[model samples]
Target: MPSVTTPPADSLLQHRAFVAFWFARIASGFGFQMLSVAVGWQIYAVTGRAFDLGLIGLVQFVPSLLLALPAGHVADQFERRRIVLLGQVVEWIAIALLTGMSLAHGIHEVGILLLVCVIGIAKAFEFPALQSMLPALVPAAILPRAMAVSASAGQAAMIMGPALGGFLYVAGPGVVYSVCGALYLVSVALMGRLHYEQAPPKREPATLRTLFAGVHFIRARKDVLGVISLDLFAVLLGGATALLPIFARDILHTGPWGLGLLRAAPAVGALLMSVWLARHSLQQRVGTIMFAAVAGFGVATLVFAVSTTLWLSLAALFALGAFDMVSMVIRGALVQLETPDDMRGRVSAVNAIFINTSNQLGEFESGMLAAWVGAVSATVIGGIGTLAVVGLWMGMFPTLRQRQRLHVEAAAPADTR
Candidate 1:
């Protein structure tokens, strides 16, 4: 195996393409986070139903579930920057339409959901391309740190975006949508300026075999499969954030601003953790570290589920974000290191499927359960499920649990032996 390369003293921000990409992520992420807050609040406010909030997640998830494979194939066969640019352009248009509709006072629940679907379709393509582009933007040795630094940008957006959205929502949902459109516009322009050496396209026909290549690659790599599936199940059940608006409005007796704070709490913790990760990479027993982080996440979710006070809930959410970031960074770097460059788009697509399922679909599950039982009960169950998954996964993937390092010089699981 080749010796593990150390990152240089030069800052990751020194790379112009990465800087451009970083800014793009921040701008888009800010818009998306704010949009999410506004949408969740507006939908629940209009309908006075928790199930509608879940529907918001379900509508967005449908497009990704259907298009994920094709989207991955598209990313591998086209210019990544262009694909990302086009997707953002579509998202910007959808936001603009939402802005116009809200300004007209004609926004209906159905219309909002339909537009969210459009944005989801665009995101379905954007995610894989954007994810695959990162390793190409910096030296492979420093990609982990670059990822951490880039993630900090997203965390910062989430922290500010929700609060800002809640504040702007006081003016009107129209105001929030307009601001989201502007941010997306900025993101599109930055993506347009992003430049890197062109890697030749894979230029493969769109057969089922090509579309599912990422699936095949992951199945062949047990550690990679274990890491991703662990994240998937952990997050899928612990998606208690879907019930935040309910807690804020009904239980906590807070307004949109309170909901915004609730949303931003996690980001605050994530941002702090990302900064720490940027400075210090996990060097040994990384597998144990990842599992511990997930365990922490489960515990924090339980705390939030039971907490009645605002401050306690916020504290729990903060801890949840911090724990999740540790696991996320470890999982991201490990998967990227284990996959070949040519297969990254497909693998990332598969990874995105897991992420979207755990996020969007999880929101649906939370909403349904919350309606059937109660928000607190639903969240408590999710937290417990997450804890159960950890134990099951630890038993199922002994190699992952026992692994010592993040970097693997070879892609195959057998190579380490």
Candidate 2:
């Protein structure tokens, strides 16, 4: 008699909840990318100062940092889906205001900064709840695969959203803003349909202890601490995106089209890698794989820093993105699986803090360093720093370095090692 193989696991798309979540992500992601482009272009058109443009990032980052803990608490204490909905509603309203302002020719630096700040606050609340919602959307067995598929949605939006916004901007920025509002409306509708079932959280006082629970939990969980920190330092040091404009203009001797290709290359690589991962889940040696990927990311950054031609730089950026995706999938799955339901919101908030801060800081770091040394030299330094981080983390996080699989249970017994 032939041995029987169990039926294949159900596709994540078949699940109504995950499907709704995935579509919501795509719509929202697209809207956000489009909004960002329009806002930056309009702001520059209104005010020629590059200093004001820097203010956009400053306002966004400050609110996220200040509100992250409270947002996590809110996510933990309330219904996540409802919180996400309310946050998106705030964002939708903000987009509408942007549309109205742009149409009426009332848009200005102050108003744009203020509205962007509002969106930042909403995101602070939305992110923790949103990130924590994923584990409950699918089976534990296929969570990693689901994460990959979900990530692909963001990558797709990143690849096309700006282009779509740019194309629409040919009419007027108001037109782009109008389209973003429409996309956001679609996102809100999909999120309204998302199915989420979580037990009501116990009412707890908002104390330092309560708010900081996620941080404490991470410190106690060596594997989690390692993974999260590994990602933080790796991104903080290895990121070379800030130098792309310089590369395209000065080094590669190309125009805006070349700059656009350079910007899209990473997302293109990440999207293709995610599609592949969605089809083929990792079965073993996940810890080593994640570290190796990070190392590869560093190497790719080094190559991108050195390459003078557009195509070579694009290839290197593409490799950087592919490697980053592998590690990201592993890190996301590990954090989701190892964490309990109650702690997920806070933990995810902490994770978001690391991610958001690193990205902002990485850009700042690159810019400042480039001001002192030069763009190419700065990127070279970042790549070297990233590799150093990987080596240091491996020695410090033996358990994480030795992790063999994605399952929480598999990681538990060897966690102390």
Candidate 3:
């Protein structure tokens, strides 16, 4: 193994493969963010139903849940970049279908949702392959900085994409979908430029046991389990993004552009924090910092729930995003560093499921709860639930609470049993 000098934040941009991969993330993330804003606005406009907004998340999540194990296996068994390329192709086709539907102007909600499911399938496979490929792109010493830089790029896209989507939506839905498709094309081109040699995969026979190995690996690693699960429940309860349409149109009485600003607020905060973290890595008390971030996220959610003033709401959202970014950086570094190389795909797949559950299922939960109570009350209750979860987790997982550092030795193959 070659010694990797810990490069300064700007110098990390010089690594060719990492740069290509970073660009790929930015392009894809921007397109997806635009698609999210467009879809939420379009669906709410057509149906005037909050549950339908939740259904969008549910529709996408099912494919990811069903394909999680198979997707991970495919990543481990095949050329990881090829799998990502295929996933992008699938996304392109889905976007094209959506564009055609928007151009036709029939407003088929079910059709739009069906296309979202296809995108979800693409995401299921792509996420693990992309995550597992990262360690191969840069040496271990720079992995945390690389993760921070990659996250910052994604956040930058998130900030721009939603605002751009809102502005483009004024022209028409067709325009937004067309632009999103073009961005995916750019991402495909960048991903094609990435070059890395993966080790030959072990010739393990496919079996039920093999498919579930990732689950077993996570179960055995208590620290990994604790960190991921903490994120899972906290975000599941605290997530307010699903109800932003309600907040913008009904609560704040803002239009589509206002919705875009609300959506971008959190990413703006995350981007600033990500840039800072890229320069100054968190070197000690990693677990404690993550817990504090989650608690702060809950506090911000509570503040946002009650604020009728748009500026106040945006401020609360910015705080929420800033805290969530801290947790994201720490948890991401832990997941990649702690898992073995051969199982990276599987472990990443499991992590994806946890994330998807927190986000998608959380959306579903928020929608249902909002339907039961009002959106404001549901959001407040969620904030309370999030704070409670953090308190419970801190008590339950002492090892995670006391963990002091983010660095780990290089992953070696280990027994699955």
Candidate 4:
């Protein structure tokens, strides 16, 4: 992989491979979002149980925890392009199998669960390898901008995927799943065009010892640990996405479009923030900014809990997304800067697990709490819990408070001795 010391804004645009990768990712993300909504809708229509929905989240998350390190090991031992290509192949096969099952009209709940589980397995390997490949496409200096671009692309897909999925579900879930499978095939084709400088992995034995080394490396560094923990707790508590459909139906008293707006608000906010951040990176006080942003997210969540008006709720969710984007940018930059090249796969694997695991756990927590304490109370309590987590993390990691931008140069052995 080539590393650029200085990257101009035009660099990413100038590279045809990078452009191809970005567009393919955008299309693939859109397809996946559609698949999720279609699958969840079908499951709920069949089971009519909230916990069943929560289980969808759980199934997706379990693979990340179990396979993250192994996936990382494979990523480290192979060419990243091949790794990503393999993921695309797996995704398409999973979707094809799912579509076939759905069209057969004899598919049961267990069958749907199995397909969703397979999707999760594919994702477990896909995200970390894709993230680790970022530095190979763009220079170190423009990494933040590159990340912002990718984030914005995903946000754009969020805007289109769900609304379209909802409309297509009315037509037929099998149709939506088939379309999604086709998109995956297209993504595979697009990814095939990406060309990168490749090198062979070290011949040293790949073992659990190396996996533990990655965990040990992250745990030993206060800076790295602080960033990961901040994200883990903040997102775990502040994520209200799991409860949105309930709010849209009961609290806001709005129809599908309104629900779509509520769903899209955060992405809209994140997309705008991403565009702004691309123009000027957060190269100063990145850690403080992350904390402050999370605090704002908590505040926004609290506001949304109390709001009845659709527009007001939308505003709150938008604010939450803006804050979430800040945390995402800072934490991602910190990880990219602190982790070594050889360790990137394993470290990013751990990071992916924490991030996705929180999302699943958060969904379960939010769903269960909402069932127990009612929706409003559950959301409010979660918001408050997120604030508490931020406060506690700040007290424990004083280094984060005095931080600046990440130093993109390779870090020393992280003082693990």
Best by lDDT: 2
What is the full ranking by lDDT, best candidate first? 2, 1, 3, 4
User: Going through the candidates in order, what is the number of backbone clashes in each?
Assistant: 0, 0, 0, 0
lDDT of 2 at 251: 96
TM-score, model 3 to reference: 0.86
Candidate 1: stretches off by over 4 Å = 1-5, 8-10, 37-56, 99-113, 169-175, 244-260, 306-310, 364-381, 410-417
Q: Tell me each candidate's TM-score.
A: 0.86, 0.95, 0.86, 0.89
Model 3 segments more than 4 A misplaced: 1-6, 36-56, 97-114, 169-175, 245-259, 306-308, 370-377, 411-417
**Model 4: per-residue Cα lDDT over 135-247, one tens digit each:** 67765666777788878888888888887888998878889999898888878888888877655666446777876666888898888899898889887887787899999
Name the Cα RMSD for model 4: 3.2
Number of clashing residue pairs, candidate 1: 0
Could you tell me which 10 consecutive residues in candidate 3 have the lowest summed lDDT? 408-417
Across residues 24-49, which tens digit of lDDT does each residue of candidate 3 receive?
A: 89889989989998999998888899
Q: How does candidate 2 fare on TM-score?
A: 0.95
Badly placed stretches (over 4 Å) of model 4 are: 1-9, 43-55, 101-108, 255-257, 371-374, 411-417
lDDT scores for all predictions? 0.88, 0.89, 0.87, 0.82
Per-residue lDDT tens digits of candidate 2, residues 1-417? 111121155567677899899989999999999998888898999999999888998888998999999898888888999999999999989989998988898888899999999999999999999998998897776788889999999999999998898889999988998888888889889888877899878879899998999999999989999999999999998779988899999999999999989999999999999998888777678989999999999999999999988889999999999999999999999998888888888999999999987898888899999999999999999999999999999999998888877765633536643
